[model samples]
Target: MLHTNARPSDRHRPRGARGFGLAESLVALSLLALLLASGLRGGTALRDRWATAGARDALVALVHEARSRAVERGGAVVVLDASTHVARLESGGDSVRQLRLASEFGVQLDLGARDEVRLVFDAAGVGRMASRSLHLTRGASSARLVVSTYGRVR
Candidate 1:
């Protein structure tokens, strides 16, 4: 069978012997490098996301504890120490509960203007502070925890 549409170069070597050209090889290597770089970036982002989420959960639990204690002890204070990553609940000038966020989540806090944040809850379990914003960071990721005046967390 004579092929009329075949290329002039097709008359040379046997079939099934073709290999990747230089351009194909370079493109493959480039794609592999891109995938590796993205994977590393994704891993760092995942780590930071997990840490920030853990910190947020800890904050909500601490806030709830403070509110509950205030209902029982007249009033309670939740003092967050950014430097040490410790949160303390105080009632009647005595510590009721204390937790270290960094010990578990390895997160850092950024509270504007001060290294501490104090949110007070009254006997009715209502928050005494205005809407407060706290920033939690771990490595390259960050998250916000907004505490409403009614002690609601988001």
Candidate 2:
């Protein structure tokens, strides 16, 4: 007898429910925040991977350039300045290329028990330092670059 003006569907009100309440909204919001946090973590991991890979690739390319320059110019030298974190390419007593490892790629280079490591390539593209191991690191990723005596990279 107390029937108000309510829609037919609203009259039934399945399970006697009105609509979403504050509790339901809070639950949905919490779920969304959890998913967002997980996604951000994945993105951070991906960024670290890219940074590490970029540093490693730059070192490899530097080595290749030094080798080719030696063959073309009869001799080339790469000086790794641990203090400055720079890789300098010298040809004819001039700095042909300089790579700022830390500033450019946010990578750290470890030179074992030395402040400098010099790599010289002869006219025949032969490397003087053999079995020299270099470590490139960024964030949680790391890679080892080794130059063999036979001008081969391992």
Candidate 3:
């Protein structure tokens, strides 16, 4: 039985929720697009940051490798910054090189001095009679790879 004041049409109202109107649908679509755009932009930025950091870490690791190789081979291993994106290791100033690597991440290397030839790590894992400064850079960020006067790497 229906209430005395209830309209007959109201009795026939369908159960459950109603569907969205055109205006509501449009507003929802707009909100979704905005969210998607923000997410994609953030993702791209994070990827670039990761790539840059990865490149920096890899270069540091290469320095360690060069030193270790020099000690293992009982000779001077020269680490050269062939370019902003390339590096190589030459043993005993010979044309024959042991290892070479190119940047796979979003970073670059800039030598502090043009006159600087190459990093020579002796058989004891110590830099040659000199210290060198290798600059690790990315776009606007930079880190100094300093070799101490005592042939210590820092």
* Candidate with best lDDT: 1
- Tens-digit lDDT track of model 3 for 54-112: 65566567667777777878755555554635656666556444333334655566665
TM-score-better candidate, 1 vs 3: 1
Per-residue lDDT value at 16 in model 3: 52
lDDT (0 to 1) per candidate: 0.88, 0.83, 0.63
Per-residue alpha-carbon lDDT of candidate 1 for residues 1-154, written as tens digits (9 for 90 to 100): 7658757887686887688999999999999999999899889889889989888888899999889989998999999898988888899899988877778788888887789888999999999898889898888888899999888888
**Any runs in candidate 1 off by more than 4 Å, and if so which?**
1-41
| Candidate 2 clashes between residue pairs 3 or more apart in a chain or in different chains | none
Comparing 1 and 2 on lDDT, the stronger one: 1
Q: How high is the lDDT of residue 126 in model 1?
A: 94
Best by TM-score: 2
lDDT for predicted candidate 3 compared with the true structure: 0.63
Clashing pairs in 3: none
Error of 3 at 95 (Å): 8.8
Model 3: runs farther than 4 Å from truth?
1-25, 36-48, 82-84, 92-103
lDDT computed for candidate 1: 0.88
Encode model 2's per-residue lDDT on 50-137: one tens digit a residue: 7767877887888889899999999888898878878889977889999898898787888878889888899988898856777777
